[model samples]
Target: MWKPILLILLMIFIGVVGFHIIEGWPFLDCLYMTIITIFTVGFKEVKNLSPQGRIFTIFIILGGVGTAIFTLTKLGEILYEGGINRFLRRRKMEKKLKSLKNHYIICGHGRMGKTVRERLEEEKLPFVVVDNNEKKLLELKQTYRCLYIEGDAAQEEVLNKAGIKKAKGLAALLSSDADNLYLVLTVKLINPSLFVLSKAMDEEAERKILQVGANKVVSPYKLSGLKIAQGLIRPTLVDFMDLIIRRKELSLYMEEFTVKRDSDIVNRNLSECDIRRTTNVIVVAMKKPGEDIVFNPSPDIKVETGDTLLVLGDKEAIDHFEKSYLGGIS
Candidate 1:
């Protein structure tokens, strides 16, 4: 903006001074002549001019027209590239992120974190990714439309921007163990109620991670070896579970839902709730807070708040059960 203004002012000054010196016109008359010439108004000159003045007017016109065209072009590019449209889109995204509740935050975008995000998408869960990798963010934007903010995960400001206070959970999957530990600690301090999951690089880090308030710690290397071992002995069982869980096109998948405080099913026994009869969904297990998971819970077990129900059913059935039974708390 300043460039075009200064250039045009310099051109006009040169025109005015040259005309005043060459034609010996009054200062006002020279200024008027300069303005008319630069604008190509074709008005009559203030006074009859020498040949040198006409040549100078010709130069003024050329410079003024060139500067005007350049200014307009640069202004157009600025408006198109860094103007209101980009700002509005960014504001819209920020507003949406702020309004998110019960959404998960993924603190890294490495291989493990990307896989976690894919699984979340498969389950139709909302999530946001926080990382400092511009290239990874660009690639993720192309492939996934979930909310993402680029920043240091260990920083409270970044977590607050991701709505950690309202977020249901967060996963710390940064490359380094120290960073993940710091990220987990920060999240716990910000929202102690929020469930935290962190990735562990070393076996010794798992205990430290739990002490730092991570509810669960995942180590991809450890899980891969277990899966391989399971496949060797329980091949058919593994295939069956995979067929049910991995094949989303099928009518069955495993899911979990939290029992809310005011849910209708709270304090009611499983048989009384009659989940299978009403929703045609199986309640595979239930875990009370600080209690062991009761696999294939009995009909007489009572539901309670903070209990997580592991269920297996179709997507629509799960949604219906969650809404109608969980009291729509989320």
Candidate 2:
């Protein structure tokens, strides 16, 4: 594009200089004559041309017209190719977005949003990212090959494009608390049942965000401060948590499973399930509906339908336990 444009400009300068030197016309008249001749506007000459001037004008016409045509052709080709490619990519993206169901929607592509995306991806959860910044979205797509929508996350249209209606949950991690607040409100209005998690910079923002509709609010600074304090007080405990939660080199994993109403474990006690012996998974805690979580639940406690169990074990053990006892993946 630049090469062709520069060639056209060079041709014009040659024409202008040639007319000024050959015909002794003023700079302005020479410019007018050059533009008219090059463009084939068929306008009358600024003044009668000398033999030498007419010869110069002919050469100028040939070079200028040829360059202009070349430039136009290149411009047209670029526009056509770019337009078609964009159309096809958007069509493919829309098709994929529509096909998604029970997926998570992540708003913003900043630090918090990126962290959320990575964690979800690590867990093998299906999700789509939304961001108003095209550059950031493109970078993410290139790096992770993940699905994303380029638009303001706070807007209903953008959320709808991200399949907000069918999404199981959404995370609002926009740069500003105000943006996240608006996003949560918009999301709740569209799908009140959809769970929303948002980030806030301060307690005030967290309060407002919760009031708006966010199911949970997190503050990075507050969490960081607490982690630092905990590290100072109980470094060993933090290291243990990091080992399992980060899953760097350890095989241990923590996962939650819901007790289906029809499962065999539903009316039985923990010990009766023989989960540890059978699948090598430890029942860490249990949370019954409308009740606080019970840590290290007693083996004698009876399991009931709709109870959620937080278990800790290796991936294979958890998968086996979930499949053999809990039916299958939820």
Candidate 3:
């Protein structure tokens, strides 16, 4: 529309100027003649046309009519394709969100939220994102091929739509600490056992979020500062630890398991329990109820029900231990 309008205006300008120069006609007459000629109205010319005026009329008709057709075609194509593509994408996201369960909901798409999403992707965890910024949410959906909800995460309705009640965990990384606090509190109220990790801008905010029942509170600035110091002090050790934490194949996660009362290994020593012999996992530490953790416990240390074992091994070994001793796998 715009291009065609501009083209017509330019043709009129040329015609008016040409008539005034060659035929000595007034501006109004030249303008009237230009409009009638371009529309093929075939009205009488304002005055007798010189050969120069006839040539200018031919150029005007060619340029104006072609531009009008091109502009209309492009506009029609945009309306036809863009609208349908947007609708289909929205429908797909809705369907994906509806079927989600045991999935994570990331409240923000900022730095912390993006990092969390990447880590979850590395671990093959399912998740959906929520952000008030529609452009950012669309960008995330395109980049990660994940479902996203464009809304305020602190709102109860938005949380419910994200399946907060069925979610296994959530990460609150909204720009404002207060918003994260509100989200944590709301989620906790809705599902008391849903694990939540939230970001805090400062120590006070961190404490507030924890008080609101967030399972963990992370401060990116503080954590980054500590990481920088560790990198300088123990670069090699830090690198090794990062490898383990970031590795996907080994999946060597540190999981704590509490011995069950009826387990067969309830009264056996660590060596006699045969976790190392049977599952090839190391019991790095043991923490008795109400007691501090003991690291690298001696093999002779007695394993009892209610003692929490901090084990480190690949997923396969962990699975074997959970099945053989814990009675069922997590």
Candidate 4:
């Protein structure tokens, strides 16, 4: 791909230097003559050439013209093989993102945001990324069949293109806390029910995010410190949870499901709901809207409308449970 281009450049340089030396022409005139001779554009020379310059023109035409043709052909092949296909593929991907529903919108492709995207993809979750960096998005496409949009995430048009109104959640992991906060505010203003988790650079940003209706705010540095402490204090528990979290490699996984207002099992106690008997899935905890999560929810705890159930079980069991009873996870 590159060799032909380099050779063409070398040929042009030789032609310019030759004309300047043999014909005593200025650099600009020499360059113009070289271009015309190489492309066979049928333009007369800027000045009459010396006998030596005429001889030099013959060699320049031989080397430069052939090399130029080869370079053009190679470029044409490259465009046909890769560039055109990539453009068509991007158009197809945009259509998919525009039609997505109950999906996630990830804003940013920096380190933290990329990590979040990888985990979501590993779990087979549907999501489309929004970032202003087309190069980074291109790199991501080379590795994964991920959908993305190139635009400023803070803009309403970009968010709408990502289908933010129908999105289940938004992960605002922009490079700066201020940008993430602004994104969270914009998203929530447009879709108040959409869950938003954002990254914060400082305590003030964290407070502002929630003030703007972000459902959760994360400080990656703080989480790293807490994780290091937990690793030392409770290694066994962390390792066990890690196994359950590896959805692609492990059959057992942990997920949350919502109880609809009209579910038949609503207002019934956990014992009577008999989730374990029917689906073989364990309910690890349950949280009502605006309430604290009840860890290891007691058997007497009633399954109520608007309760979120965090369960751990095999894939088949969880699917069966979702199909039979759970409304959908928010």
lDDT of each: 0.86, 0.89, 0.84, 0.87
In candidate 1, what are the lDDT values of residues 1-330, reduced to their tens digit?
678778778877888789879888888998899888877788998888899988888888888878767776877877865676657766877998989998999999988888888889887888999999998788765543778998998888888999999998899999898888888888889999899999897988887998999999988889889888999999988788878867665678788888878888999999999999889899999999999999999999999888999999887888888888997625
Model 1's alpha-carbon lDDT is: 0.86
Q: Local error of candidate 3 at 233, Å?
A: 2.1
The better candidate by TM-score, 1 or 4, is 4
Listed in order, each prediction's TM-score against the native is 0.73, 0.74, 0.68, 0.77
Would you give me the overall lDDT of model 3? 0.84
Point out the higher-scoring one by TM-score: 2 or 4: 4
Better of 2 and 3 by lDDT: 2
Judging by lDDT against the true structure, name the best candidate.
2
Candidate that would win on TM-score: 4
Q: lDDT tens string, model 2, 1-330?
A: 588878888888999898888888899999999999888899899899999998998898888888888988998878766786667766887789999989999999887788888888887888999998877787765554678988899888889989999999999999899999999999999999998999999899999999988989999999999999999999999899888888877899998887998787889999999999999999999999889999999999999999999999999999999988888867
Quickly count the clashes in candidate 3: 0
Ranking 1 against 2 by lDDT, winner: 2
Considering only N, C-alpha and C atoms within 3 Å, which residue pairs clash in candidate 3? none
Model 1 lDDT at residue 28: 94
Q: After superposition, how far is residue 103 of candidate 2 from its true place, in Å?
A: 1.1
Question: Candidate 4: deviation at residue 264, Å?
Answer: 3.3
